[model samples]
Target: RGPQSQFTRAGVPAGFRSHPGSTHLNYMINFWSDRTPLHEAAFQGRLLHLRALIAQGFHVDTVTMDGVTPLHEACLGGRYACAKFLLDNGANAMAVSTDGATPLFNSCSSGSAACLKLILQHSASIHTTYQLASPIHEAAKKDHRECLELLLSRGAQIDLELPDVGTPLYSACMARAAACVEVLLYSGADVQIGCGPDSPLHAAVLGGGADVVHLLLDFGADGCRRNAEAKTPLDLSKPNSSVRAALLSRGPCSLSQLCRLRIRRSLGKSRLHRASSLFVPHSIKDFLLYQ
Candidate 1:
């Protein structure tokens, strides 16, 4: 029997299939009818119901037509218990949906650091192999600082770039995610790497993010850099906008700031966290670590 028959056996009401000419109804039917009892329980965070369905012989890894597993639904909805239960039952954490979203990506999408941590721990490799489904970028763009921080701590490339999304820092700037932008900078993200030819400075200004524009400049972003449009961020800013003022306020990098950048670069992204254990004075250590 086919997947359709399996679902029908699972008590999805009959007659959901649309007539040959009704593609829209067919799509709607497939979207809703393919969801099983396990999917609903996981999505709604009904732990007992999810456990009951699993006890009733529903496979933990069973997926919908779009490849959304019960684990995917749980993570997408930020249901940590449901996700944990599914994972313990041997659900595939690295399972990519038809849309290229992993359970980790959905966890980040929901801004649940707990779910994200669980998925990361279960999956041994968190490489950028799934570039289209970057959990770090999703976290940064959504301003989930704790989630992004946890990913960075676990060896996520600080400057991981995607074909469509650029680096996580750029994505954060474009989204006006100020807290996330600061987190990325402190984590040693490159300020210059933006989406293709666009500059993160340009993105910050366009997003009306005056504070983020300043943050980028503090991290050594070049204000003179032009995007594909041949416009500097200042040119894109409104004449009297705070973003314009922030862009214009940047001067030559201070000597202390330059020293901080150099030292942080020497430490590199992976060893940056160790700066906290350095033997320097508290203020100097804070300065060096961007605290």
Candidate 2:
């Protein structure tokens, strides 16, 4: 027999298929009818029920047909208590769903910074990529600045390049996430990193990110940088737009700015954060830290 017959044998109420046109009802039916009790508990954020199920010997890592474990559901929903319970019961933080999203990816995509921190403390790999996009890429694309910062502080690669989406900076620009773009830039992301017929500047222009365009220029982005189509970002900008004007007005970096950039680069990306604490004039410190 097929799955329907099996459900019948398992005492499922008859007429489950009676509402074929009711997608929402069918979804509810699937949620309750198909998911194991443990999976349902986590998805519903029922902390006490989850604990009881764990005490009754249900597996903490139980997954659905799509390979989404209980912990994945908890994190995806931003259920702190449910996630904490699941983690304490030995749920696997690294389990990937059928679509390649891990719990960390779900947490980042959902903008759950607390859940993200928990997963990171559990040794979730910041380098893990889902469809060629890392956790930071997911956070950046979704405009999850807190999650992005958490990932970066945990040693995520600032320049992680995706197959089609390019770098986290590009993703931030495409999403018009100004704060995320600032964090990535201060972390030493390459402002000129190319993304197909677009650099970060082009991505900002395409996303109508005038503020982001200004920020990029302030960080010494090359306005004249061309893409595969041989069109500079200025060429793609809208006529009479501030972004266009910003790009057009950009010029060569002065010697002082160049010296600051060189010193920051020589200090290494990880060590550049220390420049803020150095004993120097506040202006010099700002230049050193890319303020």
Candidate 3:
């Protein structure tokens, strides 16, 4: 029987079409109504229904309402059987959703080891970017340590920087996923690369992860690195006395280095300040200085 007829037989709500006007709703219905059956069968570790879908010429490449393919959902849901069936039926394992996310991305994002293994078997790109973040970054952000290990074992790039200019280690530091940060560091991720206005150390300080900051320091992350606003990670920590104390506990040299860097930055700022004053009227400058 067709997927529509099967849903009707299974007492699905009427007017529920496999293809809907709204992409999000259609994606959900495609899974819950038609694709969900296959997913459930796969989760039960059954292949009979999957085989039937293949026989019925069901396109394994079919996209749901949100442009997510069945493979994407199957991998995210950890339906190994369904994923295998789709792969066997010529489903493109590397197919990206509307958001440029692949099944591998979904698996990592969901922290599904089974799904990750199946997708990796098909050679999913370990470096694919999704919504400005890589799968490794997403896994690290979520503290999916197991998934991080699995991806690394499969040759995932430990230092893969996303489009937003952040690495997996940076995301882990930002999310305060200490274990994940450790894994990435051991795997050879660079701790010094700045993402936007903060390096991993800065992110760790900003996120209140003193342990991660210490870990980064042990890994040789430069504490004196100034961000775009000329604020060192130390300066960013002043608002939180606890974080400041933690940063201070690292020792005097680090603090001195940070202070010197900040002083140099301030000198540069003063130069710019003096240059801008040249353009201002003397009267206005006197008034501003007095104020």
Candidate 4:
């Protein structure tokens, strides 16, 4: 028997089978309390079909075995139209997957800045995590700078720690996402923070990220600091690589850089946006505020 024959033989309601074409058959056969046709339509970005299913009484907040709602699917699929429609109809923006990933996390993973902005506008928590990984970490891992900036702009904590994920800076360094590392530094990520004993500098060296190494050093990372393994950033650098040379050539940061660092620290991450308005020269303001 075909896949369709098995469903009909099992006595699924006739109304469930009447939507016609492969769209209905593909999803209805897999139906359970966990996933309904509404989820399939949303996942598939079928706005008209999703509207019809909701009109037929499908619950907007319905979750699957994995706690995936239609909104999650829509975000994961980068289906902004479907996602906005679902949000407009009251899909829970804060619904988390069984793995602890929120729709915002899924949206960042999909690299849809529009989806992320929309979810943020709905007041979704930027701190939502999948286990220990926040959406910022996910954006860094995926090398999505726009998503990272959006999260940071809305006050996403740069230093949030998951059990083993460390801070977003460490995550970006390990991923060798140079642009992410730059943005994280400019947003005032603590270079001293680490996953275990490996600081962001160590993480950058181990990943062979030369530009990120320079960026971290420029942001005042302590390259001389040793990890639990007794390895400094130079020790972790690939043999004879430029990253090692850069670490070796560096001296203590200038007094001006130190003063800038202190100023940024005093203002704290939340007030960083106000640094530009200070009366200092643009160069000094840029240095102090991470502009």
Candidate 5:
């Protein structure tokens, strides 16, 4: 007995044997899901049989086991036709898997400009927020400038914050994606937006992204700002002394010079307080002054 005979002889459910061709197709779908053929099909722009199978209900859009729909699979494989077929067959464009990933997110994350455009044209939300990672965040992380621009043009929120406090700008900065960072900043991402305990500057410092650090500084990122633990960007600097120096040496003044300026400012306030004390009437001063 072949595989089909065994499945039928084993008294599998009637649905299993009702349409053996569909059953075979379903099996192939699973195989394709694991080792995607949609990717190849999308690359080659041909998926006639796959489309017919989807039309015949062989390709279910609902999640099975991994919360991945056909759309997710198509996006993962970068198959634009498969994706279009899935979308036309009522596959939810905004469907997020158990991992909070959308087809658009995966497409952009994979750096497929064609797939990204297809999803965007089909009304995928550019500003769609996810639990941990987002399309823009993933694009920035991978330094896919074209994907990033595609998303931005579709109205992806440049400042969309992640659940763990990660932002697209922060991810771009951490990845040292200077082009992405420049695009995001030019598109109005808040440079001062802090993610969790680390600001974008802190992320750049920790990631040893000197160019990003400099770009952020030029955009008015305050290196002196501290995290939740009170660690400044300079404190976050690592083996890269160049990063440290670049961070410290902003605005024609070093961090040490800035510190001295702050100290002098404090001293000036103290002196003003002392002068106020000395000039007051004796009784009033005594009553107002606390020893």
Candidate 6:
């Protein structure tokens, strides 16, 4: 029975296995509607109490009725210490809650860069698909710039588009997460890879984020691009609104801006960060890298 210990539960997730070839000892979990003290301790970031509970035989992988482990609670609460302790004690980092959210997603939702990094260290790869709500998408939508950057640095796809959520850039625009939009754009996310036909500029206009709309234009997002309803970003803007003003003022892509876009395209997404290494003036390198 190695790491598989049977525990009857009401809402256990589909997968309940431990890390393959793990050396840490796994304990059998007890489940009930009231849940375990580990969940409480982890959610509150009570490291001393969590340590005591684990020492007293509380399973590190113990879950609730919704398949939420203490690790999920810890990440959700931004409790890096408790989360670290759980992972060290054989807790599953990839455990999904009833809502299809992993601890990594929870960390993003909580805006905890530390917890996100800790969970990423435990997990092997980023979730490229829309599964588990996409930690990258969560970070972008929640305006957690640090968490989003960490995911991107760890190879999370920048332009990952979901059926409903669009790309991370679009989601950021829709959520009015201006900083995230800028970060995604800077990180080489496609401005055109929006949700279905709706572009990030369209989303920004509809969401009333003037700053975000401007950033999209600066990044070469096509304001004339129409959505499913045949409405351009300008068309989506409200009458007498700053969004409309920004979109209208952008007019055409400037010569300098076009050159910047062209250069970045030639550099490609993988090498965008390496632009600084190019033997050029500091200002030229900064301009190329969007620094």
**Candidate with the greatest TM-score versus the true structure:** 6
Span of 10 residues, lowest total lDDT, candidate 4: 1-10
TM-score to true structure, per model: 0.85, 0.83, 0.67, 0.83, 0.68, 0.86
Task: Give the alpha carbon lDDT tens digit for every residue of 15-76 in model 3.
Answer: 34445453221223444434444444444545777676545444556554445676777777
Q: Candidate 3 vs candidate 4: which has greater lDDT?
A: 4
Clashing pairs for predicted structure model 4, backbone only: 34-64
Model 5's alpha-carbon lDDT is 0.67
Put down candidate 2 lDDT per residue, 121-144, tens digits, no spaces. 898898874655368888987889
**What lDDT score belongs to each candidate, Candidate 1 first?**
0.83, 0.78, 0.68, 0.80, 0.67, 0.82
- In candidate 4, stretches whose alpha carbon ends up further than 4 angstroms from where it belongs are 1-37, 289-291
RMSD of every prediction: 6.6, 7.1, 14.9, 5.2, 14.1, 6.3
Q: How many backbone clashes does candidate 6 have?
A: 0
Tell me model 1's lDDT, rounded to 2 decimals. 0.83
Residue 138 C-alpha lDDT in model 5: 86
State each candidate's clash count: 0, 0, 2, 1, 0, 0
TM-score of 1: 0.85
lDDT pick, better of 1 and 3? 1
Best-to-worst ranking by lDDT? 1, 6, 4, 2, 3, 5
